[model samples]
Target: MPLNEDLPRGDAEYLSQSCFQFHEVPGSKSVTARALFLAAAARGTTVLRMPLVSDDSLGFAEGLAALGYRLEREPDRWTVEGRVRGPAAEEASVFCRDGATTARFLPVLAAAGRGVFRFDASAQMRRRPLGPLTRALRDLGVTLVHQEREDHHPLTVHADGIKGGHVTLDAGLSSQFLTALLLVGPLSEQGLTITVTDLVSAPYVDITVAMMERFGVRVQRDGNTFTVPAQPYTATDYTIEPDASTASYFLAAAALTGHRVTVPGLGSGSLQGDLRFAQVLARMGAHVALAEDHVTVTGAPGGRLAGITVNMRDISDTVPTLAAIAPFADGPVRIEDVYNTRIKECDRLEACAENLRALGVPVHIGRDWIEIHPSRPRPAHIACHDDHRIAMAFSITALRTPGITLDNPGCVKKTFPGFHRALNDLRTIWHRDQ
Candidate 1:
């Protein structure tokens, strides 16, 4: 498939069969990309197997190439040659499109380079906030100027060696800021000491720690303070585990559609924090079986969905899936600890409520939490707001309703480029263009 092609659209009404077979481990592309960049920063050759080849990861690879790193991709693995001595930052520009992971990770890498370079992106990427990271970079003596909005993207980084020190951040918005600093902290001249205020999505930081260890870096954590030692990362072979966040949708499908779904690559031991989503499924009355390399979910008998309240700070990525399954439950479901969702690809809370209302589900939105009530079935075409999670969440509703049409279904390419194909592989699909 072409990189820029729109996602294929089809009426999900034809999804009547059960049982899904997923072969690959759901690799965490975000972790893989950051690990690869760190390997490159270490100036040694590193081999990464089963790394995610999604658009976001590709964007990061492109930015690294512009900075003088050579990356070779084989059918089964990728090799990155590091530019550990720092790249000559001679006025280069990288277009990150809508990939925020690229937009954030590359700037920190650029901060460690020699000259000045510009990083710009599509309209959506430009709107994503970069204040926390930009401020952190500035504190490290690196010159960073935003070309457009004050805290938004399309920024320039004038390279200088990192002089890390005590820093504080509001983690309520996005964990990407923390992830960016953590990945680059090992290269700081004095290392880094960070204090976080109101940190949200703490599990993501755990993933960062796991990746850091894989690259031969150790971070000391005492409560909210993280201390990094000035040690170079060791280049070694790494393999990315399957994306637990993406697997949430399939788990939800099994819970909602009475199908026995098996998502491979997520077993008893996975580094991704979103793996805790299986606990959420078990809480919601689904039968969950954890195997050595995969998880199997079976729907409750007679589709008796349970109601529970959860603070999803660590697993905020699965909020949309939870919201999609809310209407089928026996009582109201409350999802909290997700104020960060407001600034994600879209205002997920409002978008989810709006989409659920359009489908005739009674949903009440709060500043962070949303309460969803069961209602009579009413199928409607949903506006995805160009958010991949939103599009996937609503697609689950199609299984219960007559069929829910998704506008701009192609947004799934942001993460699972083969999402539609994977869905089709599980069942017979019927699609028609309007």
Candidate 2:
């Protein structure tokens, strides 16, 4: 459906070309979410530089405002004055608007404040499981009421502030659950000692801990047990790095087209686990270079890359990007340990297999793995399933293979609003003959 006063546009945008391009991608959505929440909890004022302006980040900023926190926004920076004690409102409703981070993290934040918060989500967000986080909150003495369904969204929290002692969290479903609890732990009277079981995507926990330290809160960790001391978060000016997950698409484009692409401000020094995606591309025969301030990927010789078998547990977000490039590989590409992909924005594993099949590629789907066998791809309409990753990942395939069209093109606005324009910029080349 088109916007009001805008007619439905015809024809699909086809991606093409081989050229060298350098682009600074948007701020990491993961980093932006953590920074926003930490800033809202910190004592005094905190400023975030180059924060992402996407639907997810904006949704978080707006939800905080609804809870009576003042966030002053500039074109590229955000200034938030922390209400040291917590949210000013005693009763508030936070609408996550399809941001899983917001849905998971806000409840815990509310529990630490002086209010009862009603958490609401989009139709898609409502379908996600919140048992681990919500149950853990209840055990910590926060009163949680599932307004609609148990372990699902549209829940209400009667927060008298969390006691936050010893608690165990089932981390199998989403790491954000652990991250949400960990973020609010330092504010508790007893602090928080959390023991995590069945923890997947463990690297994300490291990211949360690292960011907490940046805000003047130190989290003690030994094996699966984490202890956050009862301390106030000190406000600090922070600069967010470019999103490595978003950088993966352009890197994949270079791998597919035998060209060079560089994404500035994302490199080996970055805290994002998704930065390891460049390593996967390197294993697939792309020339990956990591500099102090940027990372670059040059296509394999003769525009052919070798397929690989990889365990994507630490970097599952790039599974779609790898799946898009798998068809062009010389052999089969098997992505393993990605069972969590199913519970994301959509059934990502099946969505990747379905879209690949639509493009005339043979794919084998397992309970936790996907194997893409090399086959000639034909033109097909790719269904994005409202997942931003699926939509962006397939755009890389469309560059070399002309017939790919995304069904829900507007879905890219969830993360990268300028994706199509950025993909088109690959056509700007300076030939030697000139």
* Winning candidate number (lDDT): 2
lDDT by residue (tens digit), candidate 1, 196-273: 886777777888887788788989999988888878888888887778888888778778866667777776666666
Backbone clashes in candidate 1 total 7
**Candidate 1 local distance difference test against the native:** 0.78
After the best TM-score superposition of candidate 1, give how far the Cα of residue 321 lies from its true spot, in angstroms.
Answer: 0.7
Number of clashes in every candidate structure?
Answer: 7, 0
Give the CA lDDT, 0 to 100, for residue 346 in model 1: 82
Each model's C-alpha lDDT? 0.78, 0.86
Q: Compose the digit string of candidate 2's lDDT tens values, residues 103-188.
A: 99888888888878898999999999999999999999899899989999999988888777999999998899999989998779
Clashing pairs in 1: 7-410, 25-265, 26-242, 26-243, 27-241, 27-242, 27-243
